[model samples]
Target: MQDTTMAGLWALGLGTVKAQSTVTKTMNASIPTLVVLANLPQLALSVIYVLVNRLLSAMAAAREWASFAHSRKGLRVTVPQGQQRSTLWLQLPYSFAIPQLVLSALLHYFVSQSLFLAQIAIFNARDETEDGGASVSSIGFSAIAIFCSLLTTGAVLVAVVLAGLVVRSEAEDGT
Candidate 1:
């Protein structure tokens, strides 16, 4: 999991570099380095969110597994207020989850759109005469854009499910 997160961060950094170069080359303007670096904090925050959530989830799962294993060993396992207590170790951020999810989805959508537009601009800059049609490069970029859009959409849907889980958990807590 840590490896995956690190890889994700690395990929995001690479993508930022590519995006910066593409935008500069296509738009024929000098994009400030800060423009690329500004997104790093948000990306880092996303990574932190993933890490913390996964870590908490793993802890909860480990607790459950250990309890089951102990029970199987013929030892009496005492659960504290097992009926009322939550098995989950980490509480979901009820108030901020939806907003964060929406922001993340929007960020992804805008970034993908920006990339798509940059590709189109590059195509136009290369072939000034051709118009109103798709070239191979444009098509390729379009496919990537579509994939990014779909990925973000899927993430948003997952957030919706997580939001539901948070609400259900709160209800279970009789809050």
Candidate 2:
């Protein structure tokens, strides 16, 4: 329980950090359109939600492992040769979740950048069809990138929900 609590606190701290960073960036940014700023709050909320929930999942796993190691269900993870054999079903939330979230965040950021660029490109393309910029190509690429971003974020959200389930089970078992 101590371990889980500590881990949860750390998770909360990291989640706060992610939220603060998003707010900081949004404040410093100079987006001209309300549409761009409109997206920031939702994205930042997502990062905070995922980070906190996933971290709690990881903490639950850790606490369960630690308790299993200490108590006797007649299960010793390590062998007589002093080989540690635990962590069979453990999933490090940060290992998978954080990177996925970061990647998704980056892609969203770029998605907006691409849209802005594409808008400018459209203006230019109308005036000059043969503009040397990779304008049209970028539009296609960014569309694909945004699709992939949604896919990744959706997957992560599902994983986090499952992780939360595991954590809840651990809590019930702990009692």
Task: Judging by lDDT against the true structure, name the best candidate.
Answer: 2
TM-score of 2: 0.37
Error of 1 at 76 (Å): 47
Off by over 4 Å in 1: 1-94, 97-141
Clashing pairs in 2: none
Q: Which tens-of-lDDT digit does each residue in 1-175 have in candidate 1?
A: 2233544534544233343234333343223443444344447547855764564454444444445533442322335453444332234333444555565656555454434323333246666645556432221122333345456656655765675565456445533
Candidate lDDT values, in order: 0.45, 0.47
Residue 37 of model 1 has an lDDT of 41
For model 1 the local lDDT of residue 72 reads: 47
Give, for candidate 2, the lowest lDDT window spanning 10 residues. Answer: 134-143
